[model samples]
Target: MATELNKGPMLGQRHVQSFLLFSAITVNFMTKFNAGVAVVAMTDAESTNPDFPEYDWDEMQRSYILSSFFWGYILTQFLGGWLCRRYGARITMFASTLGSAVLVALVPWCVSWGGWQAYCALRMAMGLFQGFVFPCIHAHLANWCPVNERNRLGALANMGIDCGTLVSMFASGLIAASSIGWPGIFYVSSGVGIFWCIMWWFFGADTPGESKLISEAERSYIENSISSSHKAKEGHAGTSIPVPWKAIWTSVPFWAYMITKCCQSWGFSTLQTEMPAYMNGVLLMDMKKNALYSALPYFASWVMAVVYLIIADILLTRNIMSITGIRKTINSIAFFVPAAALIGVGFLDSEQKTLAVVLMCTNVGINAGSTIGSTINTIDLSPNHAGILMGIANTASNVIPIVTPLLVGIMVKDNHDRQQWQVVFIISAVIFVVGDLIYLAFGQMVTQPWDAPDFLDKERSPNLQEEGYSKALEAKESTNVDEAKRKEIEAGLESEEPKKKALNDEL
Candidate 1:
C-alpha cells in the first residue's frame, strides 16, 4: 500500500473531472431554472415588452407549467442509476445533457405550435433526459474521490447547482429585458448546454484509470486511498457484480437518508419553483426586479457552500471529529437552521420586505451545508452501490417537487395573501426538522455488510479473507505509528514538561 511517504500533485485528472462536473451541473441547472425566470417574463400581465407575447394564465395554470417538469423527472431516477452502473457516467451524462439541450432549443417552437400544453410536454421531455445527470455524477465521483477528499470534492462539484441557479435567475431577467426577449432565454441556455456537452465528450472519462491525462503516481495514490470493495475493472461487464437490492431495501440508515433527502427537496423545490411567484405576487416586484432578487439567495448559498466545505475538510483532516459525527453534526445544522429561517419568513409581512428576503437568503445559504452531509453520505454507507442508492434516495425525494407546487397552489389560493404563505413555510419547517431527527437516530458512515462483493462465498475464500484481515491490521498499525510520531513532534513544540505525557493527554 502507498503510504504518507509517497506523494503526488494535488491537482491532476481528479481536479479536471471536478471542473468538468462543476460545469455540467451549472449548465444543467441553468436549463432547469430558465423556466423559473422565463415564465415570469412570458406571463407578466403588466409587462409592456411588445416583442414578447404575454400569455393569459392564472396562478393554477402557472403552477402546472412549473410542476410539469417533474412528471418525467420522477420516472427515470432509479433507471438512470441502473444505467449509470451498467454503462458509465460519461455516456449517461453526455446523453442527458445533449437531449436536454435539444429540447431547450425547441421550446420556443413548441410554445408557438401548441401554447402552454405543448410547452409543458417539452419540459417533461427535457426532465426525462436530465434525470440521468445526478445519479451519473454521483456514480462517477464514487469512482474518483478518495474517502478523505469526499467533503471538499463533493462540495466543489455540487456548488454548480447554486452557481447555475444564480446565473439563471440573474441572467434570465436581463435577457428578457433585452431586445432578444423571452425566446432569447431558451436559445442562450441551449447554446451553453451544447457547449458543455462538447467539452464533456472530449475531456471526461469514467475513472482515473481510464483517463489519458492522469499520471501514474496520482492514479496509484487514489487507488491506495480508496477501499478495496469500490475498485471496479475499467471495462468489465455489469453482469459481473450483482447489486444487493434486498440488503439495501432493508437498511434503516438508507431510509433515514431518504427521509432527509425528501425534506430538503421539499424546501428546495418550494424556493426554486415558487419564489418568483411569491416575489411578484406578494412582494409586488416586477419581472426584472424579481429576477435580480431571486438570484441573491442562491448566490449566498454558493458562498456558504464554500465555507461549509472548508470547515468540513478542516474537521476531517485534523481529526477533530469522527466521520459519522461530522456528517450528523453538519446535517443537523443544515436542516434545523433552515427550518427556523423558513418559519421566520412566514411571519414577515410585505411591510417587512428586507427582513423577509434576508431570512430566505439565510435559509438557503445555511442549507448548502447539506452537500457535506446527506449529499455525500451515499458513498460513505456503500461506495460500490453509490449510484443505485443515489437513484433510490433521489427518486423518493423528487416526489416532493411534484407535490410541493400543487400544495402551494392549494394553500396559497390567493398568491398575494401573506398568511397563506406563512402556512406553507411552517409546513416546510416541520418537514425539515423531522427529517433531521430521523437521520440523527439512524444515519451512519460505516460500510454495510451488503457492500461486500463476495460475502456469500465464505467457504471458498476463508484463507484469503484471513490474509486480507492480517494485511488490514498491519496497515492500521502503521497508521498508528505515524500518528504517534506526529503527536510527539507536537508535544515537543509545546512548553517542554519534565513529566512524560500520557496517550490520553493528546487530542
Candidate 2:
C-alpha cells in the first residue's frame, strides 16, 4: 500500500529521485557546444578541405555562426513554458534531449553540405530543442525539491554547465589535437546525450508522488514541508490562482528577476561564445590554449555558485536570514566581484595580455549570481508556480544573444581591434551594476494572496453560503464573536418573509 501510495502527485519521495535523475539529464543535455569546443580543431580543415575548404573566415563570421543558436532558443521559450505547464516536465525533457541529439548528429553533414549555411540551420534547430530544456527543468525542480533545498538541488542540475564545459574543453581539445578530427568530438559528446535520453524514457516521472520506489519516511518528510503549500488539505493551496499570474505580471519582484537575468546572461554569454575568439584575436592566444582560458571562467563560476547556494540555503531555511535579506547580500557580493573584474578589462590592449586574462576570469566568475537571483528565487516567490516564472524570464533575457551579436558586430573594428572588445566589456559591467541595484531595492521572495480584502479563499465547498443560511449563521467575514452573533441574527431576521394579516379580518 505504501508503495502504491507514493505514485500519485508531486510530493512523494519518488519525486525526489525524479528530480535527481533530471539533474543528470539536464547536465548531459546542455553540452552541445560543438561551436566552441570543436571549432579551432575543424577551422583549418574547414578552410582547406575540398567540401568546405577555403572560405573567407575571420572572428566576425565565426561569431555569427555561433550566435545562430540563440535565434532558435529564444523563439521556443514561450511555447515551451506553456507546454511544460500543460504536458509535464518529463515529456518535455525526453523530447528536448532527443531533439538536440538529432541536431548535433547533423553537424558534420552541415560541414560537408553547405558549410556555413548548413551550420547555421542545424545550430538554430539545436537552439529550438535547447530552449525548452531550461524551463522544463525548472518545472520539475520546483515540485521535486522542497523550497529550502531548492538551490543546492538547482545548483546540482546547473552544475551541468561545468560538466559540459569540462568535457568540451579538456576532452574535446585532446581529441581535436589528436587523431580524431573535429567531427570525432561531436560523435563522442552526442553518445552521452543519447544514453541519457534512454534513461529518461525509462525512469523519469512527472512528479514525486507518482514514483514507484519511494520510501515512506522520505515521502512523509516532503509532505510535511509542503503541507503549508498546494499540498495542504484545503483553501489557499487548492485555490492557487491558475498559473500564478497575479504575482508574475503585477509584482515588483518579477521585473527585478528578469533584469538580473538579462544582466547575468549578458555577462556570461560573452564568455561562453565570444571570449575564446577574443583571446585569439586580441590577446593572441593560440587554439589549444584558448580552449582552457575560455573554459576556466565557466569552471570558476560553477564552483563558486555551488558553494554559495549550499551555505545560503542552510541559513535561509534555518531562520538565520529572510529571503530578501539573503538575496541582497549574496547577490551584492557576487555582483561586485565580477563587476570589479570587468571594470579592469577596459584596460586590456594586447600589451597586458596576462592581466587581461585575469580580469576576464574574475569578470566571468561574478555572473554565478544569476543562479541565486533568477534561478533559485523562483521557489522563494511561489514554489507552486515557479516553472512558468522561469520560462517568462528565460524568454525575456535570451534576447541578449540576439542583441549582443549585433552589438559586437558593430563594435569590433574588423574583429581584431582591442578597443571594440573592451567597449563590450564596459557595457556589460554597467548592465550588471544596474541590475544589482534593481534587485536590492525592489525584490521580495514570497507573496500571499489572502493579503487582499476582496480575494475569496477558494477552497470552501460551493454550498457554504447555503449551509450557513440553514444554520442561521453569518458569512465568514464577521470580524469578532460578537459581530458574528449579531450578523447571524440580522441575517435570520432579514431572510424570513413577513406574515400578512387580511384587512377584512382586522376591520
Candidate 3:
C-alpha cells in the first residue's frame, strides 16, 4: 500500500522556506533595533537635518526607551509557544511581523504626542507581538527541516539576527542623515516588514504536506527524515502536544541551557543596546561613523556563523565528533573567546581606538558560535516541544535586556568615564565564562525521555492518525504526476481504503 517517491532537486522547497524565514528575522531585527540607532539621532545636541526635531531626553529617559521593547517582550514568550502549537508558525509569525510593523510606523507620531512615555508604550506593544519570533522559528524548523540538515538550515535562518543587525545599524545612520531624517528609519523598516508579510502570506507553509508548491518527493523526504519517532510524527501537524511541566521544570540539562541563555543575554544586551552610546561617549565618533563601526562587528558575526555552520556540518557528517561533543565544544569557544575579548575591550582607552574596535568585533563575531551551540538544542531535546522550550528559555533570558539598560544607566553616571564602562564589560565577561561552564557540565544533544510520553501507549487517537493520512494523500494530490504515477497513486489509495474505513470506525 506504500510507494517510494524519487528524490527531488538538490535545492528543494525547504530552502525556499528557509530563505523566507531568514528574511522575516532580518525584518524583525531591523524593527527591533531601529530605535537603538534612531535614538542617537533623536537626542543629539544638534540635529544634522534641521527639518527634524531633536528631543532633549536625558540618559535615564533614553535608557527607558531603549529597554521598553523588552518590557512587553517578556510577557508573550509562553503565549507565543501556545499560539504556534494551536495554530502554526506561519500564521503566528505573520501576526508578529504585521503587528510590529504597524507599531513601528506609529512611533514618530506617538513620541510627538505623549513624549517618551508614549514612545515606550508603543515599543512595548511592538515587543509583545515580536516576542513570537524565535518560538515560531524553532517550531517551524522542527517541522520543516530534516534531522541531517538541521545544523545548516538552523544556522541559515538564525543568521538573520546578525544580518538584520548589520543592515539596520549601518543604514539607520545614513537614512537619518538623509533628507527624510530619523523618521525614515522606522518607515523603511516598516515597509520591509510589510513586504515580507506579503511574501510569507502567499508562500509560507507550516509543513511540507501543507505546501502546494513542494514536490511529492521533497515532501516525502522531509517528512520521512524528520518523523523518525512517534513524537516526530505528532509534531508534524502542529497539534497540541501535552506539556510535561514537572519534567521540564525538574530537568537539569534544561536548566543548564536556560542559564547559558541568560548569561549570553546579559552580555549580548549590554553590547546591543549600549554600543551606540559607547561609540559616542568614549570613542568620540559621530553618528555616521558610529553606525559603521557598530555594524562592522555584526557583519563579522554573520560571516563567522556561516563558517561555524559549515564546520559543524562537516564534523557531524564525517562523524569526527558526536553532536554532544560539537555542541559543547563550539559553545565553549563562543563563550570563552567573547569573554576574553570583552575584557580586552574594557581595558582599551579612546587612544587605542583601532584595537578597541578590533576587540569589539572579535567579541561579537566569535559569539555567533552560540547559534550553532545551544540555540537549536531545544529541537534536539524534543522536536515536539521545541516551541515551548524556546518560549520558556526566551522568557527568562529576555529579562536581562530589560534590566541591563536600567543598570547601565545607574552605574555609569558619565558614559565618558572609562572606569565605569570597564566595570560593565568585566561583569558581562564574567557572566559569559560562568554560563558556558554550566552548559559544558550539564548540556545534552540527545532526545529526552519526556519528548514522547505517548510512546508506550499502544493506542492513539484514530482521528489524528486519519488526519495524518489525509495530509499525505493531499500532498500526493498536489504534486504533478505522469499517467503511470497517477495510476500507481490511485492503486495505493484503493489499497488504503479498507484501512481508512477501519480508522473511521474506530473513531
Candidate 4:
C-alpha cells in the first residue's frame, strides 16, 4: 500500500484515456435516452397504424403518453441524486438502465392491450430511471475530468445526451418503418439498454483514475487534479467533500442556476415532449416526415453546441476572456439563437416546412448554449457540491416537463393550432431571455464565498491546503531528512569509537 501520494505523474496519455471514457460514457448515455428517441421517432406511423391497437394516434392520448414520463422524471430528481451519491455512479445508473430496459421490453405488450393508464405507468417507470441520467453524469464528470477541461469535457459528455436523442430519432425512423414496425422500435431500444449494462460493469470505473481502461498518464492526471484541488485545504476535508446543504440551498448563485435551468427546460422539454406531435399534427406532416424532421433540429443543435464549447475552451485556455465572459457569452447566445429561431417558427406554416424545420433546428441548437446551465455555475457556485446542486437544478428542470405539458394541453386543445403553439413559443422564449439575463447578472465562475482562501479569514486550520498542497513532495522531503540524519549519526559513531569496538568484537 503505497498511498495516493506515490501514484506519481505520467505524461501524454490523458487525451487517449479521455476519449475511451467518453466512448464508454456515450454507450451508457445512448441507453438512457433510447426510450425518448424511440417514442418520438415512432410517433407519426404508430399513431396512424391500425395494425397496432395501442397505436391510437389521438393527439390527447399521444400527448398523454409522451407527457407521462416527465411526471416520473421530475419526481425522481431528489431521490435520484441521493441514490447516485450513495450507490456510486456505475451501480445506480446501471440499475436505472437495466430496469428501464426490462420495462421497455414489456411496453409493446402492455401498451397494446393494457390501455392508457398502464402505458402511462410504464412511461412513469421509465422516467424514474431516466431521472438519474444527468445526475449520474454530473457525479461522474466531476470525478473523471480535470477542472480546466470541465467545460469541454462537460460538453463532450453531454454530446452523448444530444447524440442519443438525435441518433434515436434517426435510427428509430429507420427501424420503425421496418417490418417489425413501432413495437419493434421499443424492442430494439430495450435490448440495447440491457446489453449496455453488461458493458458498463466490465469497463466503467467509479472514478477515472481507477478505471483499468484509463491509461497511466490519464490516471495520474486525474489523481493530480484531486491532489492539487486540496493543496490549499491542508488535511481538513479528507478524501470526500462534506455536503453543505444550507449554503448550497440558500445561495443566490445556486438559485440563479436553478432559475436558468428552469427557463431553459421550459423551452427544451417542449421540444422533447411535444415537438414530434407538434410537427406531425400542427404542421400537417405525415409520420415518417415527422420523425425525419424531428431529428434535424437536434442534429444541427448538437453540432453547434460542440463547436461552441470548443471555441469557449479555446478562449479560456488562451486567456482571451474571463470565465465569466465565456459563461455570459454562451448563455446569452444560447438564448439568442433559440429565441430568434422559435420566433421565426411563429411566422411559418406547412407550406414553408423546409424553413420551419430549419428554424426548429436552430432553436434547439441554441439550447446547447445552456451548457453553462449544465456545467459552469455548478462548479462555480459549489465545486464541493456541484453534482448535488446539478441534481437540484435537474430536479427543477423536471418541473418544466410536468407543468409545460399541462399548460400546453390547455392552450393547444387541438394539436394543429399554430396560434396556440406560437403562444407557447413566445412564453418559452421569454423564459430563456429572462433566465439568461439573471445568470449574466448574478452568476459567476468561482465557487462559494468560502472557496476563496482568505475570504472568511477563519484561523488557518490545516484543511486549507488539502487541494493545493503537495503531500507527496512533503513526504519525499521528510524521508530524505530522516535518512540524512541516520547517516550523520552512524558516521559520527564510526569516527568516534565504532572502529575500536569493531576490532575488539572480532578478537
Segments of candidate 4 deviating more than 4 angstroms: 1-50, 226-240, 372-376, 450-507
Q: Write the per-residue lDDT of candidate 3 for residues 296-413, one digit (tens) a residue.
A: 9999999999999989999999999999999999999999999999888888888988888899899999999999998889988888788899999999999999999998899889
Candidate 2 has which clashing residue pairs, if any? 7-209, 7-210, 8-209, 15-208, 47-54
Q: lDDT score of model 2?
A: 0.67
Give the candidate number with the greatest lDDT: 3
Residue runs of model 3 more than 4 Å from their true location after superposition:
1-7, 45-47, 228-240, 453-507
**Candidate 1 positional error at 296, Å:** 0.5
User: Per-residue lDDT for 220-319 in model 4, tens only?
Assistant: 6565665225321232211244465556677887788788888887888777667766786668876667668877877887888778887887889999
Query: Which lDDT value does model 1 have at 270?
Result: 89
| Candidate-wise lDDT, in order | 0.84, 0.67, 0.88, 0.68
Weakest 10 consecutive residues of candidate 2 by summed lDDT: 46-55
TM-score of each: 0.88, 0.79, 0.87, 0.80
lDDT of 2 by residue, 398-477 (tens): 88876776678668865568777778878887887888888888777775453222233452444676677756655334
Return the clash pairs for model 1, or none. Answer: none
> Model 1: per-residue lDDT, tens digit, 346-375?
787768878878998999999998888888
Candidate 3 clashing pairs, residues 3+ apart or interchain: none
Ranked by TM-score, the better of candidates 2 and 3 is: 3
Ten-residue region with minimum lDDT total, candidate 1:
230-239
Candidate 2 Cα outliers beyond 4 Å, as residue runs: 1-31, 44-55, 227-241, 244-247, 349-351, 448-507
